[model samples]
Target: MKYYQKALYDEMTSFYLITCDDEGDKLGRIRSLIGGLVRKARQVIGQEGDDKVRIHQLLQLFYGDWGFHCDPEHYFEAENLYLAYVLETHSGMPVSLGALLLYLADSLKLPLYPVNFPTQLILRAEVDNEVAFIDPWNGHYLSQAHLQKLYEGAFGFGAEISSEELERADVNTLLNRFRQLAKNALIRENRNDAAYRYIASLLRYHPEDPYEIRDRGLVLAQMGCYQAAAEDLQYFVDQCPQDPTSFLLTAQLAELKDHFSELH
Candidate 1:
């Protein structure tokens, strides 16, 4: 119960509760899940005072005994965003899986932090003054070369992994990434209403963010909120004139206005 760890736990739990539509005790359920893992992890790590050994055991508990893994086939499934669903199904995309790993690492008193890496969510672990990067999709340790390869894959060849890219992400940063991922997944699945909810939530946290505004506009258009979509798209085009997507949105705005005029 360090202050930062508790704050992160509470924030993540609150976000989970906010996303649920049913009447169940989402907080309690999440607490129970983490509590069970904590107990089991403690049992496995008993008398093993080595931080490295404890980390290995915890990974075994998570990836081996508990069977958490990435589900690549249905990569954009909206259900993969929830911790409860990921815990139950043992499969989730990177963000949810990374969050779960960070939470468990906190409970087990391991020095782990979330890294909001480009196009992936990863963890940074500190053991005995040495740092290691972990791929949360699986509990594999990543070398600087491995991370460089990932960075190049995302940003094209010759891109290098920078210190900023590996910096520890604060809780707010992690939550923002989670919501963005959720929004995109929902949009990909054609669940426009759900996607809109995520966009709205992000907007409340980061008012008038141009990218989110654009995403909101896209979701609104899909849901037939043409006027709102047009307004949002217009705002984005006006604010970010040179953005790569702004030109495309400019065209979309013209078409949207035409469609609106036709209706009128």
Candidate 2:
């Protein structure tokens, strides 16, 4: 997580290097780590087979021998989202685990990418010249027919799945998912300051994201930064004038500013 310098935090930028444009220390370290994993996976899979066989072997090595799966013990743990910790523990949430194995696949020359599943993170890979939607968290290959059922289970029983649901996720989308994971956990645990930091990072990448701006304002208010909170809330209200919560946000912004005035 950005190579700690006397700071102890679970929130990290180590995974952020994967989507980074420029070559820097964090990106280089990430490359080195992924390279090692790819080399290890190659040793397990060997080079005697075609792409299909290699992909199968790669899955077996990661999901079987490596025993990498979702962290059933601690589902919301921040360490589960940290790449280095996930690699070491061999357990993580869907996005973290999926991205790690996906990186290895990319390094190994396998045509694999992440799918922006509406409910959860998954992977898409080419196997036998066909697309195999993978539930990387469990190492299961999901078929088209079964996708609807999985979607129903995740979203709701009556919900319908469409072809457009299988869209690819971009780098920023992936990073935003990572940030939200930590943000949700921090807010849930009442760590408002840390949550504010996480949401601030998210807003930096997604400046116009209304919900993030709204939530960041709420987080700041909880952390006693009333003026800053009021500013963010006002910005959200102004930028998203038609927002469903605009009236509520206006009320909150006024209250936040009043608190700031009283304190000052």
lDDT of each: 0.77, 0.71
Which ranges of candidate 2 are over 4 A from the true structure? 1-35, 154-158, 190-212, 245-264
Which RMSD values do the candidates have, in order? Answer: 2.5, 6.7
Query: Native-vs-model 1 lDDT?
Result: 0.77
The digit string of per-residue lDDT tens for model 1 on 125-242 reads 8888889888888899999998998889999999888798797876677666766676777787788766776677768877979989999999999888888999999999899999
Give per-residue CA lDDT, model 2, range 157-247, as digits (tens). 9788776668656656555666667777667677675566566666677788878987888788888889878888888888888988888
The TM-score of predicted model 1 comes to 0.89
Which candidate should be chosen as best, given lDDT against the real structure? 1
